[model samples]
Each structure stands twice: as structure tokens, then as C-alpha cells.
Target: MSQDKTILVVGTYDTKDDELNYMSNCIRGQGGQVLSMDVSVLGDPTAPTDYSKHVVAEEGGSSIEAAIDSGDENTAMQIMAHGASMLALRLYREGKIDGVVVLGGTMGTDLALDVCQALPLGVPKYVVSTVSFSQLLPPERLAADIQMILWAGGLYGLNSVCKSSLSQAAGAVLGAARAVEKPKGDRPLIGMTSFGKTILRYMITLKPALEERGFEVAVFHATGMGGRAFESLAAEGSFACAMDFATQEVGNHIFGGLSAGADRLTNAGATATPQIVAPACYDLVDLVGWKPVPEQMGDKPAHDHNRLLKAVVLSASERRDVALAHAEKLSGAKGPTTFIMPKGGCNEWDRPGADLHDAAGLAAFVSAIEDAMPDNVDYVPLDCHINDAQFCETVLSIFDGWLENGVVKA
Candidate 1:
């Protein structure tokens, strides 16, 4: 509904021509500009695309002829997905598009996932997929801010039921682009990760302190999805500095639990985003309500974090393995990095006399980190709990020094 807004409409134009055209018209009727990207690998699109399937394939490093000659649908899909992602990201960075909308059942949604992730945050992304919100989808496959709508009655052809969903998705993406405020220019963004309210006591002190020092702090929760978003953004070089505490997802990843992904702790280092890493909640791994604890971890102390969330304590070996894994990842940092160990305890459940308390396990983690840390990486151990005021002060003090030394911009 905005005159100046531009939306990138993407789909397998060879098959869903009618639906894609209808959606494009709806977007145009709502006063939004459209840039259609056709990801068709088999046949030609019924309607003209601003970026054709062949062009997309070329951008992705393959020729449409090669894809067609091979006669492999999966290979063609992969090529088109990569090309569309490359073109979409180029258009976005060049200011040619402000939002993206893609329609598909399976192939289209897969392609949409690639394109949506290519675009940065604040560029609204919407997906109309028949498989919307299916539990079978992995967290790594879905973009953090993508809005998906179930494509009811949109399996083969467009119908009245399908039109209803299509019309709403068209309007919502345009509306979001118009309503979302443009970020103020070039301010340094600091990313901080936190667990839930259990650790909110000390986490609340961070934003204000960082803001006072003239940095914008974005705090992401340490849930599986939250960790994915944080690391994804970090990999994109979205932050001037990073504080990756609440690292339960790292342990969860190693143990095949509710992990962000296997690559969670590796991005900030890869991107060289000056980061301070901590082992917050590294003593616990998450389990879903519907699933029973794995037999290997059944004997560990467990607690219900909420109705659908379960937290299981890890053994000393588990903690040591987690710490070693993290040390291996941090050792690869190309930028300034610090690993802070809170000696008193890492989590609320790990404090003295708590149900999950294990001093030996905590000690194992610290010892592993100390032994495996690379020479360039700073390992700072504090004699305080993770949530202690002293730990908070120590974190801020280290960050401040980085600021003064120009390791991070304020």
C-alpha cells in the first residue's frame, strides 16, 4: 500500500504462473512496485520476469542449458536457488528492492529460504508455502524474520481460498516495508545474547550500560531459534562487537539436542567480529516436552523450564567436551576475542547446593578452556557467578578497553 516501496516476487514461474501473476497484480494494485524473479528450471514462465530462470542460473554459476541437459530436477533446483539468492542480494544491496515475497509448495519454499537469507534484516520477507510451519523443517533452513503463511488450496492452481491468503501476504509485506522505520545511519551495533528470565537479573544491566557508552545493543534470547538468528547476523558482519554468552545452544548442538546449528559458535570468529565469549548455561542441554530424555542422559538431573521446555544437566565429561569444542572454534578467530569464565557458577541451576550443582563439572570446563585456548585469544577467569555484579562489571570493563583501543567502534 506504499507508493515508494518495492517488493521482489519470487516463485517457480514455470508451474505457478497464474498464482504468481495474481499475486503480482495484487501487489501492484496495493501501490507497490514489483520485481518478479522466475526460478523455473524446467519450462519457460508464462509471464515475463524481471530476472529470468536462465539469468538466475547463470548468476548461480551454472547454465540453464547445463541444468536442462543434465535432466536432473534437484540439480536445477539447487542452481536456480543459488542464482536467485545472488541476484536478490545484489538487488537489495543496490537499493532496488525493499521486500520479498515467494510462493511455492516444496521446491518454491526451498528456493525462498535461500533468497530470504541472502537479504539482510529489516528487509521484510514473506513466504506462502503449503508446508508452512511444519516441524520437519530445521531451524537452520528457515530465516529468522521470515513471515510464512500456509498456502491453503494452493497445491495445483489458484482458487478463492488461495487468493485470500495471497492477497493478505501481498498487503502485509508492503505494509511492513512502509511502516518499519529505516535504521539511523552507521551507528555501531553491539550484539549480546542472554538466556531467559532466569538470567535476566544481570542481563538487564547490560543494555543500559552499553547504551550509555553510545553503542546500540541488540539482545537475543538463547533459545534455539534465537541462537540461529544471532549467529546468522554475526556471520553477515551485522555487529561491531559481540558478547556471546548463554551458550547452552553450543552444548545442545554437540549433543544433538535443540541446537542453533553446529556452526553457532564459529561465525563471530569467522567474520572477525570482536567478541567476548562466555559459558553461560553450558551445563544444561534442552529437550522438548513431547520427547523423552535420551537414554544416555536419563540419569542426569532434569527440570521443567516451562510446559514445553525441559533442561537436563550435563556430566563433567560433557561440560569438558563442550568447553573443548568451544575452545577449538574460538582458536580460529581472526579478530580480537575473549573467553570469560565465571568460576563461581555458569547457570542458576549450577550454583551451590542447587539440584544441578556439580563443582567438579564446572572445574573441568574451566580447565579445558584454559588448556585449549589459543595464544591470541584472551581467557579471563573471574571468581564470581555468571550473574554476579562483579561479572557484569568485568564484562563491561573488558569491552570498554576494546572500545578505547579501537578494537570496537562506539
Candidate 2:
């Protein structure tokens, strides 16, 4: 028999009472238990909630009276958001809720992001927001696995148009709760990052090879969003080892292109996860293809990946900056660290005769990496392209040594 699934319905119940209750009813109609949390600073819901406004406020280290006394909408909402997020996390930890669905226009959505982020990646976190998919929310504010549904025409009262969104969100969160299969941790898991096989082929060789050594390998795409997910898991100490080979997101973050965040390369180090690092694709930054090219890129050679993304090759000086940034980030690692330098090239596109090949830039990057490498890092330089067989062999050799020395758990 399946376990009973409970979905937490959260909203500003004082203002969105009908909408919140309707969503709760929808979940109940589908045989899912409903736990309502009211995050309202003032006013009262038509019906009492499972977790009330006063409870949420006090849990956040303040009270409803204090929130109202602040006399600023932003301040009051922040207090409520903090409280709601803590309460949501507490509920999940106590096994009182399986999934969470938060409803709101702007204030509610803002709080919802914090609440959802407080939960781990696997638990279903659905946000029914008026600003769903809007650019207003930055990549860092998003939880890696969060699901958002646009609360169309549902800002004020209950209506058929709004009901359509609410009902789907209700069903989605409940269904997700019933179906989620979280990480089992049966085997030591390795988190690796790379782009497409054509761009970065190391994963194609490394993944199966690592699995053969009695490990599970998860490869992230190394795009802005993908890097965020990798960092989130790394911060949680989820990876037995992190083979972070494709690091384009670092360049992206530095150049104000499609960025993960400033914390893109810092999480694994902070968590003391044994990390094997490389500057793969460190010479390029990704920009939105459909938008006007930023002035700084200034006619630099670019590879148009698709209508959605364009890879901009950096100058020799820019590549040097990237190299220094990588070294700086790696210097903070608390666990075992190895820095691999594939001297010939970092990616397939940067090989000789390739479209993005820049011998001078590659040389500059190599020199900078050698100069800035921290004393804590074990630097390994190989005269091979990152896509070459020798690069994969070196990685495995380092990994095997770590295993034998107990730097990494098998």
C-alpha cells in the first residue's frame, strides 16, 4: 500500500482565503491531505489554519504585533516570509507535510521562494504565482527543483480563470508528493558537470568509468541553472566527490552573461566535498542569443549555439582573469582538492583549427593558472586537450589515488 500524502497549502489567508481554501479542497478531493499555513500579518481568515499567522510570526523570531508595528510593507512581509519559511521547514522535518504549494501575487511569491528554498531539492515545492517565469526573480533565489504555475487572473477573488491555475497547482503538488523518489544513498554518488558531448566529452568517458568503480555519477549541464543545482547539492554535502570539469558558469557569472550567481564555484569548497577541478570551457562566456550583444563583448568571435544562447570567446586578458578567479575559488576548499590543467585546450571548440581556437588566449590562461594556483591545491598539468583520452585517464588516476588515501569514500 502507498503512504498517505499530505500537501501543505500556504498563502496570505487573510487576503486570499477563498483561493487558498479552494486549493485545499481540490487536494482533498484528490484524496491528498491538506495542511494550511496562514502567513498574513493582519486580518483573519474565514476559517482557522493548521498553522496561524501568530505562530508563523513568533517562529520567525518576531510576533504579529511586531510585524504590524514596523509600519513598512516590505519589512512586515519579510518578517512573515522568514517565519513562513522556518515553519515550512519545521513541518517537513517533523514529517507533517510531504509537499508545499504557495499562492500569491508578489508578496506571497517572494515569501514562497524562501519557504521552498528552505526545503531540500527533492520535496515538491510548487509556487502558484502571478509572476511565474518572470525575469524579476534571480537564479540564486530559486530552489533547484521548484515548480511554478502562473496564477492567472487570480490576484483578488476566486474565478474560473484563476481556478484553472489553482486546481492544476493543487493536483501537481499532491501528485508530485505521491511520486517523488528521493536519493537513496545506496552507493557513493559522484556529481560531475559538463556541457553537451560535442562541447565537453569528459563525462561520456568518466561517468561509466566511475560507475564501474562502484559509484553513481550525476552529470550536470553546466549552464546557469544546471550549475546552480550542482552547487546546491554540493553545499548539502550530497556528493562523495565532485568532478567539476566544465566551469563555464564561472565565466558567465564574472562577465554578467547568463550567470548562476556569485556563489557558483564556492559551495563545494565551503562544504569540504572532495573536489577535482578543471578550467574546462573557462575561456568562454554565454550570453542570451536573442538580445543585443553586450558592448564589452565588442565583436568578439562567438558561436551561436541556438536562438537561445551564444558562446562568446574571451580575450587573452579576460581569460587570464578567469584563470585567477578559478584559482581564488579553489583556495577556499576545506577538503581534498586537485586542479587539472589540460594544456592543449579546455574544450573541443578551442582545439586548433576549431572555430573558437585562440592560441594566445589559451597561453595566457595557462600561465595565469600556474601563477595563481594556491599552496593548498595539488596542481596537475597535462599536455593534452580536455576532450582527449589522456585527460580522462588522469582524472581517474587522481580519483583512484584519493580513494586509496581515504580522501574520498568508496
Candidate 3:
């Protein structure tokens, strides 16, 4: 059930007619507006379509179907994603859509998430899938907002037990849509990520710099979704600017870790707007538990940054690959964009007594970035270390310039 409050039901009408209708009826029976959008990947249905989306209700609102005839697979996929997003957005604007419910095995879940993910974060997006029971990412990777994954083996067509399951799912999403209270604020949102080493830089300098400039910052820890989040918010228009301060996700993303959350590290940076970036945590990847540093890592070197945080020192080649990926993403950075580097240390842990500190690794990271990056960006090197007072000041000054005067502060 939707943890928040109003319920919206979504599904593919062509294949799952009996099931989608059953869930819609259940939601309506409980006093929720069943905003059912028919996604016809097969052929057009008779349901009352939303706009030019080729959807219509057959026996009035009781049965829904697709309106289009046979089409190419890729074309159909694009249509489903577009139509799903449109339906959700329309409902969202009218204040009717609260929580969204989606059903199907693979294509069904994919189409549903297309719409569900379009909903806001606090809003619940629930999907009952068959293929997803094995690994959640295969399907969930498509979801943008908060999602609930339930593996019902395979709920392809309608049946007695399947109907019962869909009914309950519908009940949940409806309850949530009606109750969630959207937070109200006028703060200009900016998304950021920080780690223990550089949390001070965010709290001490960057946050204030933006807040003083009238931007409200939303900071996420540089765990895994760190860089991804900062950039995603920028894409959703949630943030005025994204300060990917602690780009720790890059290590997890490139090195194979469960934390990167399935997508590219900086998918959002591929879009417009200038984003400030640095090798915040280009040090290495952390393993689950140091049980002899695994096998392939082989006598290379390691750093156990406590009992939990185990980082494998990245090799020069790996560092170059990461730098290339990062550069490719930021090559799309428009307006006033700058890649800042600190000659000293990128993180506090890189200084004196920190366990994971590796000067050679940090240097390799810098060299990789410098070499792999295109000539389009303005790369600056600060003489002081990352946490040094002057370096922090320089970052803030540059940020102010981007926000106001236009390029290179002080």
C-alpha cells in the first residue's frame, strides 16, 4: 500500500486487460479516483484515451484498450515511455495523482515505471513484477522516484490469486496518494553529496556560499548515489546548481560495487548547465568485508579505513578509464563550467593519519583527469590541498561567478 496517501493505477491494456481492470475497480471501490492510462504496445484499445495517446475505454470506463495498430518494437517502446510520462504529469498537475500502482511481468513493469518514476520522490511507486523477483535492478533501474519491489513469480495474465494480489496493491497506492503532504518551501534547491573527509568543506564553505546567493542546498552523502543524485536533481529542475563535491560514487560505479544504483555515475551531467566537479573520492572502491582482499586484487595493495570501509587502491589504468567516463559526461556541460583540482589532497582521509590515504593513487587520478579531458573545459589547479582555506575560498569565489557575474570568480 502507498505509505503516503491518493492512488493512480497504471498497466499495459493490450495484454493485461483482465488484471488492470480488476485493480482499477478495486481502487475505485475504496473511494479513490482510478486514473487508468492504457499503454498499448500491441494494438489500440477502445478506452477513452488521454490526449492523442491512442487509448480508449471499451465498455465505457470498465474496460481499457489500445488504439494503435501493429508497430515496430523500438517505436512502440518509445511511445509507451512518452505516453506514460504524459499521463502521470497531467494527473500530477491536477493534484489527482498521489501514489501510483503498476503491474505486469517485464514490459508491464517497464511501462508502469515510466509513468511511476515521473511522480515526485515522496510519492510511492509500487510495482508487482515476475522477472524482478530475481534481481530488483533489471526492472527497478527504470524507476526514478521511490519504488516498492514485490516478486510474485510471474503475474502475466489474470487469475483468481493474481486478482487478489493486484487488489491489495491497488488498495495500498490509493491510501498513499490521498495522505502525502507535499512539503512547502521557497528555498532555491541545490543538491550536493559529502563524505566524512569533506563534510566540513560543505558545511564550512560551499553551503553558505550558495545559501548567501539565495540557493537552498540539499546535500546527500557521497556514498553511492551521491554524484548521481546531485546531477539528477539538476535534471528534474529540483536544483539550481549541483555541487558534486564528494564524487565517491565514481569508484563504486567504475569498479563494480552495489552502491552506484544501476545507472551511470553522472548521467545528469550529460545534460545542460555547468556543474562543478573534482576527483572528490577517486581513490578506490570499497568491498563488502575485507576477507583477504579477494583474489583478483592479488597482493596489489589495500586500505582498511576501519572495520567497514575497505577501499582497494585503484590502478593507473582504472583511474584513466574513470577519468574518461567523467570527461565524456562533463563534455556536455554548458554555460560557465570549470574542473577544479587541488594539488595537495582531494580528501581529509588523504592527509596525515587517515588509513586510506594514498598520494600516488590521488596523483594518478589527477593525471587521468587532465589527460582524458577535452580542451572544452576550463581546468584550474589550486596550489593548496583540497581542504586548505585558500582552495575552499577559490571554489566559493568561482561558484559565485557562475551564479552572478559569469565565469571565474576573483
- Indicate which candidate wins on TM-score: 2
Error of 3 at 319 (Å): 2.0
**Candidate 1, 1-410: lDDT as tens digits:** 34799999999888899999898888899899999999987788865799998889999888889888887777878888899999999999999999999998888888889988888777899999999988756788778788999999989888899999999999999889888776564678888888776744566888899888888888888878999999888998888999998788989998977888888888899998999988888988989966888899888888888878898888888888998888888888888999898999988888898888999989988888888888978989999998889888998999989989999976
CA lDDT of each prediction against the hidden true structure:
0.87, 0.92, 0.62
Runs with alpha carbons beyond 4 Å of true place in candidate 2: 1-3
- After aligning candidate 3 to the native by TM-score, how far in Å is the CA of 141 from where it should be? 3.8
Ranking by TM-score: 2, 1, 3
Task: Give candidate 2's TM-score.
Answer: 0.97
lDDT of 2 by residue, 295-399 (tens): 978689999999999999999999988998999999999988999999999999999999999999999999999999999899999999999999999999999
lDDT of 3 by residue, 5-108 (tens): 35666666667667777777888788766666666545544565332234322312212233233235544555666666766766777877666777766666
Which residue pairs overlap in candidate 1's backbone? none
Error of 2 at 320 (Å): 1.4
Provide the lowest-lDDT 10-residue window in model 2.
Answer: 1-10
Worst 10 residues of 1 by lDDT: 195-204
